[model samples]
Target: MAVALQTLVAEAERYLASAKIHDYCPNGLQVEGRAQVRRIVSGVTASQALLDAAVEADADLILVHHGYFWKGENPCITGMKRRRLSTLLSHDISLLAFHLPLDVHPEVGNNVQLARLLDITVEGPLDPTDARVVGLLGSLPEPLSPRDFARRVHEALGREPLLVEGEQMIRRVGWCTGGGQGYIDQAIAAGVDLFISGEASEQTFHSARENGISFIAAGHHATERYGVQALGDYLARRFAVEHLFIDCPNPV
Candidate 1:
């Protein structure tokens, strides 16, 4: 089934409430392609591999969590950027990216989906006072040792997370997906026994150790893989269009 490109974009923007949130990159349609979209390919990032996969799949649109044109990035269309845009334009495939909005959505957001996968009971936002906070505070169904928690993360995400052990048993936890190690401070302040994020920084170790909070650096790509797929599935069900999630794995 084919849906108008404008209609799809509008529906996405509305569903995600894109305009209400400020983000580093523009949300909704980043590149205009065919007027009607029949098949879509979604992924965590719109890298060359994902675009190639979309092209191979004969996708009319590409939906992604990470898209181009970020704030403060070099605006020049040269080398990698040039090649990527060239491929999209040549194939006439639309690109739609949603960043923070995708991460914070209640139902299909990265943090929520990750929690659901891990059987966490969400308590509240990591920063309860901040409406825009992306990280969340929650608790496991049952407390588990640091090793067991790490093993569970590996089992669920198919990747071993870098573990910083704290307590013997972790109950209350906090998490945010995709380069959210900075939020460790907030989690610490919130008194969470463990904090999970996509990437780890040099200072993350010190913060985790000094604050006595367990830290887990799950792969950024692995942690964020769920949101785009969830959004794609929702769109597919809602619009009666085909959606494919292409996995172009990245360790970082």
Candidate 2:
């Protein structure tokens, strides 16, 4: 039994509403397509290649982490943008996107999933005041050597982590999945011994050294790919819709 497009969209939208996220792009149903969705495809970005793949799969809808109409994007429908949207519109494929909402959903969020994989117990949001804190602070079940924890992260995530060890053991850690290096200060203020994010900047080294917080930079796209995938699986099982996750490599 397939789910109606309206129903699925409503579920996703309601989920977003509950989170109260501040999103750069709109949260749900960026493009309208068939009224009924039997097959759904999800990916990290709505790139030209991903749209083509969705079309090939005869996907009724495309779910992505990064959708169109970003804050700084030109409103005009030009080269790359035109190509991506035109393909979906022509195919009558609906587009549903959840950015920060997907990152902080607690049950299906990227950060939550990453923490679960690393066996970290979430204490609270790194930024308590912000309702949509993308990062979380947590403590390890048992204290592990920094090197051992690094190896565990690499093995679980299937990618080598960039590690900067601090002076103390990492019992309490902070993590924000995908390009959240800017939150290192907040993590430090939260008194987490280690800060982990998907991407690293040159200045992050100084932040780690001076702040005395251990830092780890996992791959941005790699860390984030799980949340949307988990959401897709959940929807598929709950609503009996077929789903596929399209993978596109993003090294940064």
Candidate 3:
């Protein structure tokens, strides 16, 4: 049986502790839809294709990693923003978003999910105090060569990872899913031997070499797909809602 939209929102808000976010956008129910939600759709971004799919599936709610109303975006709902929101509102489809919350939740978070896939046991938050600490610190069950570790990441993500070996057998590893090369220094301070994140800056190579930590730049989209997918599956099972994870390829 389908659950009320409010019930799903309450569950997700409680699970993610929505108040903890210092987010650029509002974190929940960006657009209200039917009160009784029988079908839900999820995606990384609330793109046009995702909305089209949700509409075709007759979804009552859309959940996503990125939704509209970013901090600095123009307040007027016009152009692309207008179209996205208009479609959902017109179709009576609710939109629910979990951003940093989804990224930081210990069990279903992006970093933790990646760690689980790589056979790494999490130690703790990469930045313990930061609410936006999407990075995680962990260790391999046994130390693996840089090459071997890189292979593991590739196989797990099904995409070739960019590796910068820094003269260390990778046992303690640090990871932040999605464009988190900025956290390399944090990983270094935490005594990690290898740091992995989706996407890297040019300076990352120099920083990794100098800091004595091997680095891996996995694709942003690939690394982030897991957490949201897991969340979608959980919702489907819990509410018996028809949940579909819309995939939109992004190389960066």
For model 3, where is the 10-residue window of minimal lDDT?
125-134
Model 1 reaches what TM-score against the true structure? 0.98
In the range 10-65, model 1's lDDT, one tens digit per residue, is: 99888889999999999989999989999999999999999999999999999999
Error of 2 at 94 (Å): 1.2
* Candidates 2 and 3, the one with greater TM-score: 2
Q: How far is candidate 2 from the true structure (C-alpha RMSD, Å)?
A: 1.5
Candidate rank order under lDDT: 1, 2, 3
Name the regions of candidate 1 deviating beyond 4 angstroms: none
Clashing pairs in 2: none
* Cα lDDT tens digits for candidate 3, 6-35: 999888888778787787789988889999
Per-model TM-score on C-alpha atoms: 0.98, 0.94, 0.93
lDDT of each: 0.94, 0.88, 0.87
lDDT of 3 at 182: 93
For candidate 3, give the lDDT of residue 38. 82
lDDT-best of 1 and 3: 1
Residue 217 CA displacement from its true place in model 2, Å: 0.9
lDDT of the structure predicted as candidate 2: 0.88
Residue-wise C-alpha lDDT for candidate 2, range 144-204, written one tens digit per residue: 8778899998899788899998888999999899889999988888888899999999999
